[model samples]
Target: MISIELFAIGLVLKGPEIPWWLLALVIATGQIGGKLLHYYAARGSIRLPPFLRRKSANERTGRWREYLEKFRANCHRRPVWTGAVLLISAASSLPPFAAVAVIAGWAKVPLVTFLVTGFVGRFVRFGALAIAPGIVIGWL
Candidate 1:
């Protein structure tokens, strides 16, 4: 949910003071770690607060849950497509990776699939962001 682009760009601008790949790895690790927590929470491995549970049962939440159920059905029927969506969300944040994580967890997506896709996507995303400044400066 939080945007870390500025921080990553700042690290890149440090000009060899920090390794870009290392920065990308650290950022990706933290991002995936947080998403994993969301996944576990949605998977029922972590207990959510009572208020959250109550809110989730509301009409609005119910509607969203219904939609998510459909998505889960599709995930089972089309795993490769689901993985592609997850990868895109993880890398681009277009559909919001946090929401995707929750959806994947609720869908009971294989843990290995979630972790591997998430890490690879996040690494690529952050790595690109970290390197962008240098590439642009080179152009200038």
Candidate 2:
């Protein structure tokens, strides 16, 4: 399968065709791969630059730690809704997927939940995008 640009062109102009399911699969896989990479990077950033990992309770890092703890607590309180929003954001590309992934990682979302949500969201998003051109053409 080709890129999003080419896929869009194919949808709009009726260019070369691959089954819609295959295109959706490829796009979803690519999206999830990028998302996972972003998540891991955010997780790893906690240890980055020793200066930012201070142990002092009064330091800036300590404040960051407190904020993360509160966020984690919120996540625990509304795990299902949080995950649903994350999935919807990923699928719709709203509020930016990278930002959401980083937040999820920083909040320590379960790996399985993150992966599953990301995959489902990405698949649905790409599938909808793939069909959008046809819908517009029909309306026109």
The TM-score leader among the candidates is: 1
Off by over 4 Å in 1: 55-63
Error of 2 at 87 (Å): 1.0
Q: Whose lDDT is greatest here?
A: 1
What is candidate 1's lDDT per residue for 52-105, written digit by digit as tens?
775543564567768888998999899899889989999999899999999899
Query: Which pairs clash in the backbone of model 1?
Result: none
lDDT of 1: 0.89
Q: By TM-score, how accurate is candidate 2?
A: 0.74
Clashes of each: 0, 0
Candidate 1 residue 65 C-alpha distance from true site, Å = 3.1
Q: Which residue runs of candidate 2 sit more than 4 Å off their true CA positions?
A: 1-16, 45-68
Q: Against the unseen true structure, what C-alpha lDDT does each candidate score?
A: 0.89, 0.77
